[model samples]
Target chain A: MDICKRRLMKELSTAEKGLPSGLTLVSANDLTSWYIDITVDSNSLYQGQIYRLMFMYSPNYPMKVPNVQFVPDENRPIPIHPHIYANGHICLDILGDGWTPVQNTVSVCLSIQSMLAGNHTNERPPDNDSYVRSAPKYAQDSRFIYHDDSV
Target chain B: MPETETYHSETIYPVIASDIAMQGTKTIDSLNRLVDYSSLDYIDVPGHLLCPICQYPFVNPYTTKCGHTFCKECLIQALEPNVDLSVECRCPIDRRPLNRDYVEDIFPAPKIISNMVNDLVAYCPNKSRGCQFQDQRWLLQRHIKDVCDYALISCGGIKEDGSVCSQPTHRKFIMEERRIQRDYLLYGYSMLPPTNARLMYGSSNIHTKNNIKDSASSSESVETKDKSNSLKFDQPSKNNLHLNAIKDTKLYQKLASQDDMPLLELQEDIQIPCVHQESDCANGCGIKITKATKEAHNNIGCTKVMLSCEYCELQVAKPKLNLHFEQCPEMTISCSAKAYGCTWIGIRRDLEAEHQSKCHFIAMVPFLSKQDKKIELLEKENKSLRYHLDNISQSLANLPSFGNINRNDSVSSDSTTYSIETTESLGALPVLPVDLSMTNASISHMLMENDRLRADLDHLTTSLAELEMKQNTLFMQENFRNQEVMHSIKGMINTLRQQIHYILLEHRAFTTNSSNPVHIINQSSKVASTNPELLRRRLSDITRQDVKL
Candidate 1:
């Protein structure tokens, strides 16, 4: 990573309220690639589970949101939360439609933590079947409308 | 009604299935299925973190961005003391950014994978020191909060820690320490006891018992002191008294904090709204200002501004004179009429007349009194016109039927020509003649005397169907007029009901014993938004603080 991008990732990974889960940054086979899990000790639905997530950023870095996804679809697995897609796509506007470059991973993690915590309904998104198979990628298309926090 | 705990047995299935699906398809199907049901079953996690920087398990690992991590304690001691603000620690990647400390996700193994991968991992890094770690990541927070060996217990002094106190915990710690006394007490005081004596000297059991006793005594002392503090001023709240003594300080501390929630937050806390209007914004802004310093600013003169604004000839003054006048001008300030959205900014020399005539924001129509005058005029003209039209049409429609059957058989030819002319004149009016059915009952109700004809229609025809159709049409027109009158009457009633509901809701806010005051305030706020007089009257009565909710 360039000096500037790496600097932001450091403060964001360790700053106050940064990365709600105790998720640590772990490198894979390739030095450039990285992924890990966040154990959200939140009062949210995704509590008590370690959510494995991958963080992929283009060289563009801070100017664009990092590609963060709950890996292995573990704690926040898709076919579950109504507000979240089974394909690991989220319906939160702040994560996508309303995303501003100013937002950091800390804010993103906290938002997700709350998302998992407060969801009373345990059903998957209504369009899970269609979105999962036929439109598997649309959930992350960035073109999908994210009008509200709720689905 | 909310499901507190419904998905216990079946919850295992979803957790397992989701865990496998997230790992991607590279995972073996049989292994995935095996974990799909056995999710979240973990004896403990054996995370022997290996530091990327040291090429070994992290001694005191520190993380860095670009995923090229480090051993924290070693790096800190080796590098500059203050690494956070220093520019030395750069990310090992593209050299573009200096991501200082590397951080790792906690317990990366999902419960589904944890049960399997956990067996493959090394021993706990902290276990060699005799720390018997047997908890999973899920239980770690609870462990640290309730069972951590090093958890800091508050000293529970009366004043906050920021202020100096006559006493300190270190002194108390030394004097009241059971472990310390265990070494001293048995040697000095000769007090070893049998196992049955729970409070015997020098036992680990005695140490724990003493700690509990000390905790209980200190808490009771704190409670007794709190009671005297309140008894001098505040009355008892029964069970809520202790709750309040504990809670009020917390609330006060929260209020002292820089960014506490407004009244809406306290509404959640107290579960009630403050409704004393005397403490509200008497300035008529209808905004509730927090009770703070400078109470004098609350009396700023705003009455004149409200009136001037109404006329569109509003004046302005500096805020020091009256907060309302901060932007008001000597000349009439132009405020766009709130109707037809005339957002024009103009000088108000003749603004009142200009508004009365041209202000689109203000409705062109005037007050209810003026509206009543106009409506009354329209109603009178409509009623008379309706009666005249009804009379003419009814006479013509029933004329044929009302004519005698014997006379029709022998009527003269000139009379028939004369009758045709009369029917043509009557056709101009929008009314139906009386029916034959009415004539059968009584001729008086069926007939109308004409200007030129000596005989009335009822005196002539008594059995024509065409006359009946015209009569019914005339009757319908009369009913239409009646409907308008009834509608105006109903409108007045609705306006009255709305005004009363508004006054009652507003009046209840300032008064005490408002068991349902929040409900009242909510309702009044909603209604007041739509009603100008209700809003204005309420704004005058309620203090600004009352409007915070």
Candidate 2:
């Protein structure tokens, strides 16, 4: 019990220290889960866009990577483009095949914003629905598949 | 719980437990306006006379008790039940103790039947629902009592029960207010009542009740004005007429009457130009400036001031006139505040900035760094376009030189074979001696060199992808951390709310106590604990950091 408390306390204090700018931590109405809205420099395609990424820490976090989902909703107030689905589901590999324990909600959002700033293909997968539901369900150090770099 | 203010029954409560404050001359007559006086139905008090001997409603109209056939209270008093009474009880039959336990303790009649065709209550007052009243006030007393729910009372601001109406009822009253409005409507000015004259609604409340003891006891009578079902006051005029409703004798027709202010005594406090030398006095607040002063205002330096209130009319005044406004109650009111398009009239004491902060037309907070962002986006798009154009141009240039070899059949045929050959053979071409053949040397070098370059490019692309993949994973973990902190803060707030609830419960006991500074201090601290600003700021910072990440 003490260990869990200490770990969460440390995470909270760190989040407090980093929030001077626009970093926000949105906990589920219940304390069971939380998500962060990864914002990019508004100058980019992802600017003014808030890419929501959820972090599901196990009753044991950090020791293992928390389960994460880049809950992109195109229906959100954020502007839509080719790369982002209307559902806000991001096609970035880091949230999928490139999943790793070391990754966190902030890094994933930054990666997506950067990913958007550098790519041009706006189309979703031919089977976008299936892809979202059936992509590798867990982060297990899958080999990363990076394709486009040109913005 | 507050008393229902049922129009029939009254409940008195003491708010200031210490020395009373000015005896609060407010006599609020909350008549149930939703009541259909047109239908004329009720089972409340003052609806009937009681028998003097039995203290129940009068029956058989016998003059036996003191030879007076009044309600029981009258005859009971005549009996000199108490030692102070001067009258004696004389039974009509014998003049004994009047003790006829012979059915004496019971209701006298088996039934009463007047056919009530002319009486008002055969149908339920809740005419919307169809329950017949079956009897009069005394018989239906237990049934029509507030708990039974057939009672229909409503305020203009509230629905059928003084709560905001979810459904609307379209009904209006023909009140004295309508008559007074007729005066203003016809004359363009509200004439003051004659000295020693009373407003009209007073008489309406006095005699409007059908048949009851409303005047059964009082010797003195006062009258003159007001509507039976509705009361009226001049709509923000300089002239005023007052209303007075004597309590205990009668009640107003509806509960909506409670919201109207009884300015009979303090009418001047709200209506007269007691400020600014009364030079500006006219139909408007405080007073109006003279024509010369108007010229001065239109040309001379002036400070713009605005005052607004939900319940008052708008007024505009000058700051130079501040000295004259010190004693003016309406100074706190509108000061020519036309900018807001508000026509509220009130004193500065009540019209604070609270009204302005909530104005719907106020502008929203601007987007942060909007210009810098637009510039940054333009620059980034420019850079990407430049790189893309350069890439296409480089490919175009490569096609042209290769075009030369393709047009020359000798090289074209050989290149065609180069593309189709087995992978092992394509790069295994012999290195021709430089002195032996120029075309052959060029072809061999170009093919082998092309293979090596393709291999190197593949490796670099693969590495770049890995780096991007890592960046995304890191972002997901960071989001998880922030969520944890928000929950902790919310939990703290809920705990504080519970504590405050307990403190409030405890306060009800001490609100009656005269001395208890400690409770006040405790309440203040408990209130302070619930401030969400700290949590809000904390949330702001975390969101910002998440963006940077």
Candidate 3:
């Protein structure tokens, strides 16, 4: 088996057994893709809203960061924050150049959960409309300038 | 079932013997095997044993200078992408700089840590394949290699089409086939007639004879034997004779086939050779041999084996022996002066003796050797002197005044020493150099003293700046307090002036009321009318007042 599949199997088993609060593994179905639902449990601007996170893993996963985005669907929508765009692409440093191999699906989910929970602004990025119209399909391809640390 | 029973009886002996033999000689190719540790069922592995980068148990652990441990492979992969970029690689856990100066800041993990990680208990990696073996993590590899029957291995046989067999087989089936093949090769037979085989066949024969006797003794016995035979064979027999004939044929076949079973079994053995006779010598000897002769071949017969050179005592492989001889320092060679009519020849070790005695170039040899030694010694002294000169120059740059004073003092002392040398005996001239060396030592000592004083001055200057900042804040606070005091005193003076003005206005009103003469006169007449003594006293007081005025 490829290392990506082997690592995914371990992570899948761990996720199936249990996940931390506010994170639900909706469907994995295969090794290459997975879906998780994240909810902000704290009393923040996104407290009552839930967001669906889609993780697409490449063959060089863990060495290469997985592509994670808030997949807007029925009953779950993209979170509104100063760093999160309308198209659900987040500008978190860990999701971009700041990613390290030590992070996994569970850690990513918890980070997104905390990112939503810590947000106070109920709006998208300042250039949300223009960026969302021209953004790439995968968030990993975008070169986001991580100028904000207050999110 | 009957066919299987007969086959098991024939193959059982050699199978047991080969199984026992294989236990001692089992070897697994563990070098290229990649173990997936995440799939293993660990018995509570400690967190410290896991690599923080991969979140798995450490494989080939290495420790960094920052006191963090990571898997060697994980660290390499983490550093690999940054190799092309100019950025320095850092420890994944703590982000401490790792590849500084292009040197990795990591070392092999401590022995205790390696041992502890190896000692952790884990189930076999092939547990999902129905293997139940469990042991310490280090032993798990050996189990998979030597014992785990469910481990997947190639068939390791070529097909009739002249291509290697690519079918995957379980280790259990492969090992059984190897055992059978080894037993056939060593014994030259499929079945071994051990004493135990005869005992097993003898017991069955006795049971058949008892059935024949019981059937002849009574009709009830005949019915019971027929029922038992029916259950055993799943077919009803009419009488004891029929069942007895079936038993006779089974025994006869077992004995007869022991000598000439079939060509099919022989062909299978030929297709797969003995495990001992598998591969060629790994040392590149190019001769294939059985495992029994492998040790001997590697020890002595393999020409590619490493051996120590007899002349130089340097280790060189057998194939490289001639190459080593060309550069061997101890190799014997004729003297270099042979062309000059010198016939001396010997090993290089004794070449010095030849040059010292019989060589025609002897005179030049000693002179050249002496000059070489002298030049080497002079170079070493020159290096030391240059290092001292640089140090003195650096100190002079730091304190120019000190250097100037020391130079003047040394010049004056040198002049005094010269004057004394001229007056005294010639022996005192030798002491002049010693006095200059003493002055040189003192100059270095004074330079060290100057450095210490400079450090002290820097420390005091920083403390003084801190005190000055504190005093400025204190003065500003006092000035603010004085301004508040002055504002309150000015308001107090303004309130006093207003109070004096109000008193002056009240005194003027009283004087104006006293200056109303007509009202005063009426009031005096009213007083005189009320009392005659008041009028007489008023007239005498008025006359006295008029005289005083």
Candidate 4:
């Protein structure tokens, strides 16, 4: 198996045993992509809402940044935030230019969980309509200028 | 001896085989990335065997000062400053500080960890390629490369460069006679037609085909007698067909009486050439291994396989090295402004991000002063040109007769004419040019001469201005020097005045205080040519006479 698959297999097996509260692995059959379901553990705007996070790993995973977005499916809804767009594109730096290789699926999921837990605003990004309409298919493809990091 | 023999074979054989099998089935973990060893049976492994970073069995385990153990590679990666671009080094587990100064002090694999890792049974990494061999975890690489029939081997021909040819096309095969013997003993004897025919009739053909083996097996009958006797340790069943075929042969009955030996003993007798023994032995490490494990020794365990970094000259193991440029501190790298035409080359260590951050040409702002100098020169030229234009316009209005002159003569004159002087003397200058026109047939010729002189005067005045500026600076320097000299002279005059005033005072004291004792002592020194006491008495007598007077 490639390094990505081998590492994913390990991550999957570890997640199979148990994960942090409110964070659960939904589907990880594909080596290149995975879906993780996260529920805000604390009382917040997105407390009970189910949000699915889709991670598309490049061939050079752990070294290159992976494409992460809030994938709104039939059962899952996108988490409202100033940095997150309606099209599921996130302006968070870690998912963009500020990514560190040491970050893995667990860390990324937790970062997203904390991002949702800290949000008080129930709105999309300021330029949500224009950005989503012109956003690339992959979040990594867009040159996102991450200015605010509070949320 | 007979009673002990039964117990040994019955008890030890199964236990030894299973022990080897248990070891063979163990998985060899990779150090390149994180691996989950939790898939393994929890009861069979110790928690300490797992590396904290990869969560897999440690390969080259290391311990930090904090007592946290990790794979050597994982620790190195964690400690790399470029990984997170953070200046502070810290342990991944406890977030404790792991400064670079103490990173080298991290302990090597402990004795217990080394022993356990070496003892673990591991399947060949090439098991997917149909290798069935399993051995000690450390020996799997060799078994796969040297002994496994499925493992590809080099063509072994010498290249023109005197290096071994690296074409991995040849598959190692045991001798046909030996293969037959091994198959018969291990898999129950069977009478295959090819085997019977090769032994009975084709044996002569085999001897002629392989000249190297012809001497070893001189005759087919003699070869079968020796091979069958040595291979008869395993008792064949009554239903065996190969026994029926070879039993009637004369050598078969002679082999049946031979004593039995263990299969492992026979297998142990197989000697495989240490692939790099010839190359490595010249460097003083002459190691000969079994044919099954020679590949692993040369590939993994051989210290002779170290390669020097092209840039830094640091020795690195051949298999573990990636692109050295990424890690070599002394690698030569071009300046970050190479795209902007900077051609500096330096070691990676000396040129930090600061080098690019502070690069002058990259910023393109420092060179603006040079451009400013050029602009100043252009403005000076523009000022002179404006003065010349004003003179030309004023002259054109004054001399209406000058307009009819040939343009060719005016173009032939030098362009550097200083109109400043000529413009001031325009009244007299026009009269001279008009007189020259009367004498010359081409009136433009006189105008050209006048223009050339004016051009020379303009150039001369420009040079004169530069000289004047240099002279001004020189004059200022001399003036400063004179002022310093005058100040020192005034100080000397004051000192001379003070000395003259002191001398006058002393002279007055000698006149006014002649009777005084200290003045008499002074007079005695002046009169030292005479007797000293007499001079003092004479001076006192003179003072008394002067007082009487």
Candidate 5:
């Protein structure tokens, strides 16, 4: 097995054992992609709303960070945050340049959850309309400027 | 008893070893030579022993200056220059600045840490391949190299062209080859003339020769005692020769000295046939190769060696297998009209002609998909509408005046009464106060409460149905009684009319018979006055008859 797959399997087993409340592993049928359903805690501004996070792992995972993005379905929607675009592209450092091999699927989910929780305003990015119209299908393909640390 | 057992085993080991050696070159794939750590099943290794990067017990552990340990390979990969050179190398765990160029920053982990990780117990990587060996992590590599029957090793046989046989075989096969060479060398020395054997093997050869002669004489006597035992006697003599030869050449000493030596050094000129000479290909290719050309046969020549299509079971060469999959007849393919909401899925053969031509989704693509989207939207709207309507109705029913109006408008007034009674009964049922906080115990309690409430509702519904049925029967009975009363009244009116007709006829006859008109008038008046009482009696009798009928 490839090292990426092995590491993913380890992370998957640990996640399945238990996760912090509001984060759930929906499906991980293969090592390449996983679906996790995340619910913002009651204290958050977007309370009672659920969103899905889709993780696409390359064979070079850990060395290269997995592509993490929101997937909007009938029940789940892209969260309305200043750092989150309408196209489900998120501007988070850990998901981009700040990624480390130590941060696994669980930690990534928690970070996104906290990002949503810390926000007081329910709004999209300033360029949400324009960016959404021209954004790449994969969030990792587009370069994100991490300008805000307050969120 | 122990001594005899030892002697028996001592004689037996060599014979079996030689027999295995004579079987010759068996080939195995050397691709999976290294023990894969990720695949090993570790037994409860502590968290501290595990590498922070790979999250597995350390393999080639290295300690950084920050007092953190990681797998050497993981550290190297982590420190590798990024696509963007501006991003400096850093520790994966702490994000501390790391320099890949400086060797002093990271060094090999201490021996204790290495030993601790090595001491961790793990099952053989070949456990799936039927190797049951389980031991310390350090011993696993040696086990795979020296002892594992499933482990692949070089055949170590020389071809006629003076090339070393590159064919891989199991360790057992190589061990056997060494034993066969040992046996042949020993047997030749034992057959040598006494002076020649003495010169070749020195004084040690003389001692072994004496032992072999003694064993040979004892075996011959045993053979003569029973001709039937000759087959068994022959085995001991061969064992004696093997043992004597091994002792004379000091092969046993070499084997005993180095436990890790997988195969002993032997003369390079020995020719051995391929172990798989007459054996059928493991991939079920029926053709048999007669020489040590297994690598060529399996790698390129054999068509069945590679995987076949999981769907169609079509066996093709590995390079073209992926291409075959694109057009495999049995491969599952979706209809081209999938975008138009056609969910038809079948084999490639069917989808190519049958499903595509007949698909209604293709013909009505534009209109149908748009309608489908509209329908889906409408369905969502309809669902919300139904939910709102249910809420409105529930709220309206909660109002007393509205409930009364509903009861009045509905024909079944009894149903309203029954519903009121049911509500009263439901109110009488014990209501378990639910705790808002969800704990394990409270959740179970709530589940039980839900079950009890459902049972109460079920009982109430069944009883309500019964009451409704009774009310229907009562209404039907009331209607029958009203119809019977109306029929009886009609019969009484008809009898009264008949009585009036009879009285009029009598009066008419009397008037006609009388000659004086004034007397007739007076008579008629008297008769009129008397006739009423008689008519009244007759009216009562007729009513009685009607009542009896």
Candidate 6:
């Protein structure tokens, strides 16, 4: 196994024993891709909803950041906010330009859950319709101007 | 998983023989990668054993200023800045910031921790090839060099510019070879020692065996006597006796008689045969050919030799040659229609004419395009030449007028004019006289040039003003477009805010009393559905009244 796979195996074993409340690993069979579910344990928007996150890793994981995005399905609708588009593409700065290698799949999931929990208004992004028309499949590939920190 | 504490002593040095047997002769690239410490039988490895970045046991462990330990390589990788200059590195366990200064404050892990890591025993990576060796991590290199059978040693006699030849041989063979070389150098004799003499020098046991055999027998034989003398020759204390015996020999006298002979001439007389004839001759002809003759034989007479075809790799014999060029399959000849620009390659007999006839680009289009490109380049050159000619003629016309005007000045003695013969209608123009009158003409010419310059400046300023005005209007139009976009954005934001406010108010009212709120919302929705347009108008009126208030 490569370094990334070994690290994921250690993480998997640890997470199996116990993880923080409201954070769980949905599936992580291969080193290149993993899925996680996160829910904010507070009285705020997206309080009860379990948001599924997809993390795609390159062979250079732990040295290079992985691509984290909200995976929408029939059961899990995209959390509506100013930074999240209707098509489930997020515009968070840390998921793109502000990413650091020390961050892992769990950290990214927690950051996104907090971002959704802090929202006061539940609505698609301001230019959701127009942006969704031409959004890249991976949120990391999209060039987003992240000037707001309040989500 | 069994608890490691159960087998604390055994775990330190686990039964690695079977594990080494399974790996079988594979070279270890990294010792840490070879051994999975997490699964070892030793005392339970703590969480700190694994690097936070790679999740492997910490290699070259370093402690940061934040009291967190990590592999040195992993720490460097974490602190690497992304595209932006600001580094976003921090301790993974605690979110304390780490920078270059913080890293410089790093120190090696405590000695006890490092000793525990180093004490983990591992089998030799080459145990499968019959290496029965195991050692602690730090002593592995010494074991491999001193006792391992598979370690390679360089062939060490011939030196080319002080660099020993590095062709590796087995350790046992290289040791034997080095012993032979040392014995040969010490003897100061010819390199090719007699077979019996070599056996005597190979080991001291053989000499003792010969002495014991002689003693067991009743006779003190001559060969036994010579063997005893050879033993004395090897000893340093009896060296003078051997030296005196060597001087008294007839072989020494013969060598002394040849002292007058030039060494160079003697070296030339003993010529070594070419090594190629013995090695390269496959037929075993046993012909002792000299170096000069071997060169000729290699060029012509060697029938086992083969010559490769220039077009392909087909080898043909020089002595029993065949018609290789005519019959070889891969021979590449030029296209028959190469003049037509069909740049195709294959066996010319196979493809040249066939491809040329079907190639459309080669037919007429390429020729036409080639001519068009030439015409374009020629037209560009013609335009440039015309421009240069116009400039030259204008300068020539101004030259003589300036010369005549300067001739009347105090510096006229230094001004010389070359007679330019312009055999054209321009020769009929009036010429200015070289006198006080020419100075007046010069002044007027300067005045007219000044007027032309002033007019050019005026034209440029007007153009600049017009450009500024156009730019100002463009900026104004851009501002208007931006304002329109902003207005639409503001309206969208206002609607979203109102929707959010309504949802919050509904959640509050619904949560307070679910019974009456649901029935009331249902009745309100039924009334709005009956007359949707009227309901929308009333809602707008309410928003307008709110805004007025």
lDDT of 4 by residue, B1-549 (tens): 223433311111111211222443322212101112222223244766866555556666778787777766566655666566644556665656676446454777677876785566665544555666666665544444335555444333222233433444324422223334434433334243122212322222212222323422332343333344333334344324545544554334433444343322232222111222223222233664433344566676655667888888898866555656576778888776675577778887766745667677667644655676778866765665455555454443333233323353464333325333443344322335444333232333445566556566767888999999999999999999999778666656665565576467657667657668587566545556555676346435533443344
- Candidate 2, B129: how far from true, in Å? 66
Q: What 10-residue stretch in candidate 5 chain B is worst by lDDT?
A: B9-18
Each prediction's fraction of true contacts recovered: 0.00, 0.00, 0.27, 0.00, 0.50, 0.50
lDDT of 1 by residue, A24-140 (tens): 554432323356555645545555456655556555444334566655642234325776666676667655534433355556666766677666787887777876676544344
Q: Judge candidate 6 at residue B406 and give its lDDT.
A: 36
How accurate locally is residue A1 in candidate 3, as Cα lDDT from 0 to 100?
A: 42
- Candidate 6: interface RMSD in Å? 15.0
Question: Please, what are the lDDT tens digits per residue for candidate 2 over residues B1-549?
Answer: 235433222222212211112224423212222221222343442323333222223323334322334322223333333245332333422344443222352222222311121132334444454345555433333333332233322212211122322221111111122323323222322453311112222223343323122321121133223221122343323222222232332232231244443322111111111111113322233435532233344344334443332233344345534444554444555533434355555665555545445533222212324655776766765654443344333333333233233334454346445433432232233423342234333434565455345445656777889988888788777767778777666665665565467567557536734377677656655645786465346445544444334
lDDT-better candidate, 1 vs 4: 4
lDDT of 5 at B13: 15
Docking class of 6: incorrect
Which ranges of candidate 3 are over 4 A from the true structure? B1-39, B82-88, B100-104, B151-549
Q: What tens-digit string does per-residue lDDT give for candidate 3 at A12-102? A: 9889999999888999977888999888869557765678999999888777789999889854878888888888888888887677767
Each model's C-alpha lDDT? 0.40, 0.39, 0.60, 0.55, 0.65, 0.54
**Against the hidden true structure, what lDDT does model 2 obtain?**
0.39
Deviating ranges (above 4 Å) for candidate 2:
A2-5, A20-22, A28-31, A42-44, A72-103, A126-151, B1-549
lDDT of 3 by residue, B200-230 (tens): 1112222233343232233222223334434
What value does the lDDT take at residue A133 in candidate 6?
Answer: 92
Question: Whole-model lDDT for model 3 versus the true structure?
Answer: 0.60
Model 6: residues >4 Å from true position, as ranges?
A16-19, A40-44, A143-151, B1-43, B65-67, B81-113, B116-549
Candidates sorted on lDDT, descending: 5, 3, 4, 6, 1, 2
Looking at model 3, the pairs that clash are none
Instruction: Name the DockQ score for candidate 6.
Output: 0.19
Error of 6 at B486 (Å): 76
